[model samples]
Target: MVKQERAARTRRALIQAAAEVFAEVGFVPASLGAISKRAGVSNGALHFHFASKAMLAEAIETEAAETVRRLTEAARARHGDSLQAVVDATHDLMGTLAKDIVVRGGFELAGDIARRTKSPLRKEWQRWIEDSLRRAGHSGELADQVPWADAARVIVAATVGLAVLGVKDATWLSRQNVTRFWELLLPRLTGRRDTGTLVSAGSRPPAAVPAPARSPRTPPAH
Candidate 1:
């Protein structure tokens, strides 16, 4: 049992270290030795957990994909089929790109021509956006003029563009940037009246809210 726990820890450390290295250097230039050293694990230990750099990259991508899944799920849970869920999720994803090394590395790897086919992170994100848009259409949240496919394309393109640009300029991933994007686009996508209800800055996640705030305290009887 102890050995299993230790192995899990080592594997997690290697994945995180590999993500940091990959985020700093392109996948082609990233080295297992560097990952191992950053992880503070011997090369043998890294090899014991992962056989190759590609495998380690795969681990990073898988972990990143899982994180995105949970983020989208939480957003949907909060907003149901509202387009706001899509907006919130996009904001969360960009925030993740800015601060989460594994997610950033996974996205970068997803764009690498040599290894792009191996990573599903980008494709999965696009699919989720499409699915969310479709749901919004079904819920009558989408504007009459906007087709789900077109909306999905615009959103996916913008978000992916931001992620790519963020590689060189961290400012692209800032919440303000994402919020500004939604502020401009949501009005067009949902029309003027519906747009008023959506929060372009994205809604706060349920978990982030204080427990005491769930129900307001009643003042003493007047």
Candidate 2:
């Protein structure tokens, strides 16, 4: 039992370390040696956990997918004000993307052609957004003039853009940035009655201003 527990810890350490490296340099340039170094584990330990970098990336992708799945599920289960729940959940995910190396690495690595199919986190996010929008429209949370699918497309595309932009400029994930996006979007998307209750961004003080856009001449990492 002790050995099993130790092995689990080693594998988790390697996955986390690999996520950090992969998030920084992407799948092609990342190396097992670099991941092992970051993990504070020996090469032998890394090999014991994962056969190759591809396997490591798959592991990261799986973990990231699970994280998103839980977030979306919890959002949907909120049971009141579906749109507000969706908005809060999206805000939660942006914060997670800002802070979680595994989640960010999964997104970056999943975009790689060389990587094998793992859990499709991006597609999952898209589905969740569309479904949430549909739920809102059905619940009459959206104005009659708004089309759920069309609005969902705009929001999902914008969110994905933010995730990509955030890779270079973390400010893209900032509360103000997200709030500004919602501030502009909510007016168009939500019913006038629902506007006052929905939170556009996190609870962070609105004073910590967002950063300006930066060129992506350097490889992006979150």
Candidate 3:
């Protein structure tokens, strides 16, 4: 049991290290030796866990997908009542990617993986975003008259493009700028104005009550 746990830990470290190196240095320039050194693991250990660089790249993609899934799930749980839940979830999802070097690398690696392997991470991300939009009542004909699926695809594509740009040119596509871009885009997509109110999809009332004041109590004599 202990051995299995240690192996799992080592694998995770290797994945994280590889992701960092890939993000810092583009996949074409990255090396397995660098990844092993970053992870503080022997080359043989890394090979044992991941057969080749291609496999390691795939693992990074899988990790990115899993991260997006978890962030979406958390947003759903936290803001279940609001259509903004989808927006909030998307923000959280992007936030995770922006912070993780692995996710950044995965975006760059995706094209190569698609050409070389049958992995469907990009498609999965698009489907997930589309489903979220549908659930948020942003489906069907809006003012723009564009189909929801098409819009969702555009959003995903734009997001991926921005992410790649951000990785390559951090000065041009900083996290703050990316967030503000999304903030502007979301309202337009949902056909809603930024009213700055907590939109609840459920029947629950908003939490508007003020807290009770504390009574003054006599202090004990010192």
The top-ranked prediction according to TM-score is: 1
50-167: candidate 3 lDDT, tens digit per residue: 9998889889888777766666566667766344555555455445555666676776677553337654556667777787656554533232544566667767777667766766
TM-score result, candidate 3: 0.72
TM-score, per-candidate, Cα-based: 0.89, 0.84, 0.72
Pairs that clash in candidate 1: none
113-214 in candidate 2: lDDT tens per residue?
666564478888888888888888898888999999998899888887888777667888887788888888887887567688777774333221122222
Taken over the whole model, the C-alpha lDDT of each candidate is: 0.81, 0.75, 0.62
Task: Give a tens-digit lDDT track for model 1, residues 110-134.
Answer: 7778774656788789889999999
Candidate 1 TM-score, C-alpha based: 0.89
> By summed lDDT, which 10 consecutive residues of candidate 3 come out lowest?
213-222
Q: Give the Å shift of residue 169 in candidate 1.
A: 2.6
Question: Which portions of model 1 miss their true places by more than 4 Å?
Answer: 116-118, 205-222
Better of 2 and 3 by lDDT: 2
